[model samples]
Target: MGSQAPGKGAKGPRILNVNVGVLGHVDSGKTSMVAALSTKLSTAALDKHPQSKERGITLDLGFSSFSVPLPAHLQHLPYDELQFTLVDCPGHASLIRTIIGGVQIIDMMVLVVDITKGLQTQTAECLVVGEVATSNMVVALNKCDLVPAEERPKAIRKAQKRLAQTFNLTKFAGVPMVPITAKPGGGGTGTSAAPDAEGLEELQAHLVAMVPTQPRALAAAGPLLFSIDHCFPIKGQGTVLTGTVLQGAVAVGDTIELPGLKLSKQVKSMQVFKRPVTKASQGDRVGICVTQLDPSLIERGLACAPGTVPTFNGAVAAVEKIRFYAGQVPSKAKFHVSVGHTTVMASLTFFGLPDGQGVSQEAALVQMIENLGRMALTGVPMPFDKSRDYVYQGALVIGAKFDGDIHGESCRLAFYGRLVTLINPSKPAELQQLRVYKMKEKRGVIERINEDQGNAIVRGMFKKETDPAIYTGLRVVTGRGEDGVIESSFGKSGKLKVHFAKGIQQAGRSSSDNAVILRCKRYINEHDRKRLRQ
Candidate 1:
């Protein structure tokens, strides 16, 4: 998707948050359903937005605020002032990148599917996007009443079956595929109550179960990462940036920098909704008045961070799964990726999966050549360590089914950034005869019946580092790069380049200790116990 103008006002911090995104294909009833569910006060922007009103389309990312009543289920939360923020994303194919940009930060999702069409291309695309972002999802079968009164049952079942295939519904299989009359015209107020069925009570219960009361793991001092959704200028106020406060807290007089800009801003004033607030926490949407800096520096994809997060020029990201919309050709071109509000344009064509890795390797993220003929930011900043990968950052268009699968200006053929093998910066396209593989298969290393290397586990480069680095283990893992590889031939000067981390050095050890490496023996014995219990 092309860039969008920043949102109104600046951003401040508020603590309690439930950030959610609405998703589906174009005309899949995402906006209308969102407007209906949001409170009367919350429905204003969505109701008045020009694109939505006149063209009947959601052009840019739209924002509205709402609070979900904690139902009988959430009375146990540790804090109050909790609320839900619903971000309405464009369901069209063109907005795929922008859709994921917002979804990356959301805690949960409400996937709206049209009951009449059942499941469309955007539905499946968005489903994969949601899965990649977060596991929690609520399926709202909008426009259910449009189906013949009797056909509603079939419509509802169709939704239920499709949902089970794509989402992790173990939390509650009986979730509400709530049949809703989601049109904005004439008395189309949304369902304030959960749908009626034996499924109704169960669905309401599941909504409470799946919708986390608060962010799962809120870091105390990782870094302040503010993803700017809206950037605008004021008469005397200078410039202000607004969006949900993604992470960390900001205070008055704190200096904030525009990501790519050399200058920063000082906080002038801050407000959350209507109330004046001081320090904001992860999730609250606040407006901050900043003094200093050029407004031009503040752009939509600009990420404001206090301390820098570790970024690699080239990285290998595992594709947990590669799925596509039925009947649509999978996007064959290399993928351009956008995560955490930053878009990296790389010509990452797909390679086969890794064969002998310990854990099942997903699709790998490789660094590709920047198609000067195709994109702007050729090099993307891929983060490392203590990172939380969102399930559906957005939708991926598989190559096989490309054409008629996408519609209108959305099906616009464009080059994309892909996660690919980082060539040794010294030599581009270094793989001469050696085949490229993203190691994603599952492998686990266990000690033999008797061996001195009792504490170590051997596996692929992709699995999480399980053993203490002190063990002097030789495990394979992905490497990062800047210079391209020179040659494919294996030789002394051309060693398969590997990076040594500070922690891996700590894994150094000569002999065993602890009476007999008791932990290993205990683990092996308990393994059989666990299997039996399962």
Candidate 2:
């Protein structure tokens, strides 16, 4: 069932909500545009944060929505009313985590750009985030009235051309651009004071036209997963959690679990924009009230059906490096990983199939990983299967230039991936199953050879404190093309005895400077274990 509109037993038309993210650089008029278009404001809408009003910039994600009657093309859909929930994301560079969190819930995006400034740093970053997060987007060239009347058209065209060139390498190439004056005369008290917004009607029409093309399956059958963005207390009523219903439906009196705190509470009541709703489905933005929970504990987190979400300490994912990032993505490098609304420091281990060895195997694995990534980008969940084997990559170097000037200021999005395996502390065996490895090789010269015993003492391969037992039973090759195996430690010092299967060659015995090389694969997790012990 769909959420009810604001009224008492009036039985208004069923609501179909589409979340649209407003993102751009700081002071790009994203909030102004949202304020102009939104007809209804939620409790947390329009600079609700004290710092936002004080600093004259948005410091957090703001919410406001407007409703439009269902267009004729979408009449065959399930719902009769269309609501666009505007998610105004912060544009400051420091608040990119918030923008990432907000973009996760959006069905599409309206990227606001300052007409004069064109695409700034955060604007480019927001475009990158949009490329990874959502599939559909429309650019809003805001602040058109700032330019002279005669020069407005030329300036807008120049900005559009620059934006087109920027998007040429991205998936959002050729997306529609609408010039608008979100706030005329550079200031306005509210939407009522600024009624003559340039291109407002045209922008609205473009949004409506794109609505029918959006892919939405509002089936409310899966386990309920609500992304709580705002939490507050209602005095005697209870604590209310306001967020979008990402998956499944939630009804009043049903129990939902706060996965972060590992606590479950009954849903006392629910509302959609001040209207009492008995039930709400996927894509609905609603506030749920429950008793006895402190509002301060959870500012942003996931609320879901009990036992549905699992906590993992580490995860293995199929990853591809971002082309814009110039730095090297070495394995085990730490990065800020944003999962849903939470951003945490995570050490990534990258792996893939060895080239030229497995043709069919590589094709199948790549296809599977690509499918998983596509499904995830579209907000679909595809569980990682443990039955399949994944290839291990020593490092992710594809599409990267090591010879170029790597210190340039650019987007630091090194790579993105879809989860393949989750490592839980409680399940130690899961970590043991990871077979990622790095190749290690050591070179030493054969100092002395025992012709009678058919063994040679190899030195110079390791330091004095190095353990020779680790290389025991490993194959070694000589400079003269002779193959042998490391027999055992010769003495307390770092020396090993090498034994040839067919017996030491005549060249090996005559030349004491024959070089011996040992090659072995070292697992990365084992290296981590050794470092931890140190």
Please tell me which predicted candidate would have the highest lDDT against the true structure.
2
lDDT (C-alpha, whole model) for all candidates: 0.48, 0.72
Model 1 Cα displacement at 385 (Å)? 29
Candidate 1 — number of clashing residue pairs?
Answer: 71
What digit string (tens of lDDT, one per residue) describes model 2 on residues 1-534? 133444345576788888899899888888888888988888988777888787888888888888899888878776778889999898887787788778878888999999989888878878878887777899999989999999988998888998899888899888999999989987632333267778878888878878754347757767888888999999999999999887788888899998778799999988888878878777788999999999988888888888887655555665666666656665545566666676555554455454355454345335433322211111112243211211111111111122233243488565665555455423546545665444556799888888777788888887778665567788888887778988788887888889987677544444433888776666544534422110
> In model 2, where do residues sit more than 4 Å from their true spots?
1-10, 188-193, 212-214, 354-409, 425-428, 439-534
For every candidate, C-alpha RMSD to the true structure in Å? 15.5, 8.8
**How would you encode candidate 1's per-residue C-alpha lDDT over 1-534 as one tens digit per residue?**
000112235342223457778888877766666655555232224635665566677766766655545444545654433466677888877677667777866777778777667667677667666766666777877666666777768768877787766554344244456666655232332223222312223333444566554435555344566667767777877677776655566666677655455346777766555556555666656667786646675556444454353333434333322323222212234344555555544433333333354423231223222111111112323463212222121222221123333563232223222333333322334432123332222222222111232222222312243222312223332111111111111122212222223212122233221111111111112213212110
Badly placed stretches (over 4 Å) of model 1 are 1-15, 40-44, 47-49, 69-77, 148-155, 158-175, 183-206, 307-313, 316-318, 325-333, 349-405, 408-534
- Which candidate number has the best TM-score? 2
For model 1, state the Cα shift of residue 206 in Å.
Answer: 4.5
Q: For candidate 2, which ten residues in a row score worst on lDDT?
A: 389-398
